[model samples]
Target: MDTTVAADHAKLAEELPLDQIDVSDPALYQQDVWRPYFRRLRRDAPVHYCAESPVGPFWSITKHKDIVDVEVNHRVFSSSSTLGGIVLRDRPADLELPMFIAMDPPKHEAQRKVVQPIVSPENLDNLKDLIRGRIRTTLDSLPIGETFDWVDRVSIELTAQMLATLFDFPFEDRRKLSFWSDASTALPYAGTIVESEEQREEIFRECLGYFMTLWNERVNAEPRPDLISMLAHGEATRTMSPREFLGNILLLIVGGNDTTRNSMSGGVLFLSQNPEEFAKLRARPELVDSMVPEIIRYQTPIAYMRRTALEDAEIGGKTIRKSEKVAMWYISGNRDEDAIEEPDRFLIDRPRPRQHLSFGFGIHRCVGKHLAEMQLKLLWEDILRRGWTIEVLGEPKRVFSSFIHGFTEMRVRISEPR
Candidate 1:
């Protein structure tokens, strides 16, 4: 974003009537000027309502405490796909699919349990060396003193590799995992992967067809630890419908890809912007323990998770009626002053760094969070060991979406290994 545009957004956020201020505009996130708008909402109306947006009318839960209240009270606030699913925009009936994340209690728990073993402590311990080896290879292959996109070269590559391993996906076709993941969440915007909803569905059909082939093979064979096999063999997921199968596949792909990939890219950008923190990390490498969660908090990979009100509920002294949509702005909540100290600054060694809502809370909390953290810890540890100095070459080109708060490109150059 340029100086003029940023100034204009700041001005609009400050002077616009409270009801007219719509933080749902994708432009605010694309230009990386969302802080002012969210700051205004958090300060004045933590449970603010927008009567209009490109999507539709919805209530914004901006504060830390308020967002948690909504997340925990799942009975009142439903994540059911039949009630428009977990994103602010309602998908067309044909587009809607019954993923576990978008389901309510008993069903959600049963389906979620099917894949829980993939990230179990023993499994992660088994996968550690493989993750570290991949990270080392990726870092070692970067061109010294030459500018490159860290998002593609490092972040996407590493996460795609890991996602492939988790699914036991064909090693040669790993990039397809990322392409499908991007297509799954992509909206019809300029520079977006899919041109229209029809096109997006076309891509999903291809994904479903490919995965169904794998599912057939896995289902017929003896059980194994891969996600597809686990789903095929597990009692809860074995009887899933085709659409439900596709939905769960997309859910796992997006959950695995977006959270870790975006945060990896964001960490590089954050450290570049905060050189003093980078110096702190270099001087005391042990700070990586604290720095990992701090990165997730500061980056806030997925911006918000939407839930439909199952019944009238009071939050922040306001009544939200049944069927009204509410956006739990994790991005805003992570920076709430009442929750986090010096919310704007990127602190590498902050105490209680994991208090933020990046991985969410309550029963719907991220299942793969420990795996994500381990990947980050291993990657940063390898960088420190390599003694490589990474220099940011330009401002990151952010994803043009309100939902997925992420980067598309981040140019950087690595110094010669010390």
Candidate 2:
């Protein structure tokens, strides 16, 4: 961000009335100027309320400890899809998709357990060689000395392949995984990837139909290690309705694709912008161990997680009434100064890099976190070994969403060939 523009934002943030501060605008994230607004919110009102917005009324929890308090008290802060799922915007009544993440209590636990083995320490160990081989092949194929989209060629492709592997989906059709994941989270605004809810529903039906074929094939077969097979054979998930099945499939797809993919693009961008940190990392390749989590904390792929208050609750001394929405802004919490030292700096060598809220907290904490970390750790390790000089040509085209904080395009070039 330009110094003058940043100053202007800070000025506006201070001048704006407390009631007029709405951080829910997708533009704030798309333009990459959300810092000042969030900084003001953290300082002034950690549990701030916006009574009106495009996404409707909601409260924002900006501080780290406050966000964690909401996360741990999932009973009070309900994630029920009926109340309004995990995003600030409520899905249209007819199009509601009830996945386990949006369910409360025993149901959430039962369904979550069905897919837990996919990221088991044993499964992750089994996947190491496969993941590394794919990473090697993808890295080796980058166009030397030419500018290209890191998001498409590297980030999306790599994670798509991983998602395909996890679900045992058709490898040749792997790009569909990313396409459907995008559609699943896209805001139905004019000129956006998804233009309307009807279009989104059409895309959802297509995704569900494709996955249903695999489900039928797997459900009748012997149990296997793949996610589809696991779900098909697991007592809790085997009899899920078509909509519930689709919902879980979309959840796994987004969970698998976004976190690792965006972090991959973010690592390259962050390192390019901070040459000193990049130089230090290059000098000590072992720093990849800590750098991986730092990338996640800084990028914060999924910006916020929404939960509705089941009853009156106190957070940061504010009362949240029954059935009202609350957004735990992980992006803001990760940058909370009280929780993280030098919160805004992209420091890879922080003593406790993994303590951030990118993967969230409590039972709803990302089940694939270790897998995401392993993917990043392996990619960075390989990048160091290959010695390619990557440079970001310009600012990335960010996703037009406050929910999925990611890049749509990040142009980069290998300035020096390996």
Candidate 3:
């Protein structure tokens, strides 16, 4: 362990609420319990190390500028297939999928291009009506003055339906797709359910089987404008082998599922917590455009992403050696006071809110960012127009994973539309 990491850890143990700092527990992430500790880290040790983990010791890169530098310079800090995927912790071989998000340049660029057109701004605009309809239907389904799990009814449903439309999959079974995606991504944190390699392989095989069925059906059917068909019949350079295709499917499922779902739940929670901001949106719904980025900044659905140092590099005045894992704490960076004024307050009209690190930075920045924003904006618009006061009925439950930070269950009551 680096001397800095040792010293920082010792300080953290003494000054911080070390016992409550369990990154694996979703509840901790939801209540924003890590904020104070991260604030301490930012002030004390910007580039620190965690000398222990399920995946062994790793460095925690918690500053805004430092994370941007690592994200932009992909050559120095690679998201390669060999050095384990973007998550700080490594998974068992059987559960690993060769997704582009986990790949470095050339290959990552090639694979990314396959689905890039589908998520482009123009394509997203084209889907606006379809998206609005989905949101309206979802909001309508919630009976007036009823309490329900917001995570299940709103967040999961909206994203799943949008994903179903995007992939040209059967909308009726879209929830199953969300389930598989969650299971796949959460396998690393699954204690008894996915106890061993065999269990993990079984779950993945089941997911792959369903995807294979969809792939074969789409490959034979008439080409539609959906992502699957686009990849099926797009330019030669965009074509992918079955393995790569499966990898991309898994990537889409995981990427599309958690981030937006968490953001939806987080957005609602943020509004409920910050009633003033909610009232601001209620007044000027047009701010939904700017509000989307602010919500992302406040929620920060994905807590951190990992990168392996390909060579010796200096970040934030700290030396990182070759092959060392550097965890970019997006949660911490988004709240860096130097980057945004009044970083702790949730301001809907925060100018240049997109500058936050929620969606990441540079080349590997989230490709589905536009789509995520679109969905969030549409959902908020629908909620506001319905004139429903969202009340938190119970404490939200978060997913037990360090990789994807999100809510698993959040109960809320909606008042009758005025």
Write the residue-wise lDDT of candidate 1 on 37-82 in tens digits. 9989998999999998888999999999999999999999999999
Any runs in candidate 3 off by more than 4 Å, and if so which? 1-27, 93-95, 187-195, 234-242
Q: Give the residue spans of candidate 2 off by over 4 A.
A: 2-4
Ranking by lDDT: 2, 1, 3
The better-scoring model by lDDT among 1 and 3 is 1
Q: List, residue by residue over 1-418, the lDDT tens digit for candidate 3.
A: 2356556654654475433343333434544355667777777788886665566767887789888998998999988757877877676564465778889888888767877888877888899999999899888888667778999998998889988988888878998778777766664444634566666667777877877787677778887777777667656324566566667777888788777888899888888888998888888989889988888888888889889999999998989999998889898899897787889898898888788998889888889988898888888888888787898866688776666778888989888555
Candidate 1 vs candidate 3: which has greater TM-score? 1
Residue pairs whose backbone atoms clash in candidate 1: none
Local accuracy by lDDT, each model = 0.93, 0.93, 0.79
Question: Measured by C-alpha RMSD in angstroms, how accurate is candidate 3?
Answer: 4.8
Question: lDDT tens string, model 2, 146-235?
Answer: 889999999999999999999999999999999999999998879877999999989999998999999999999999899999989999
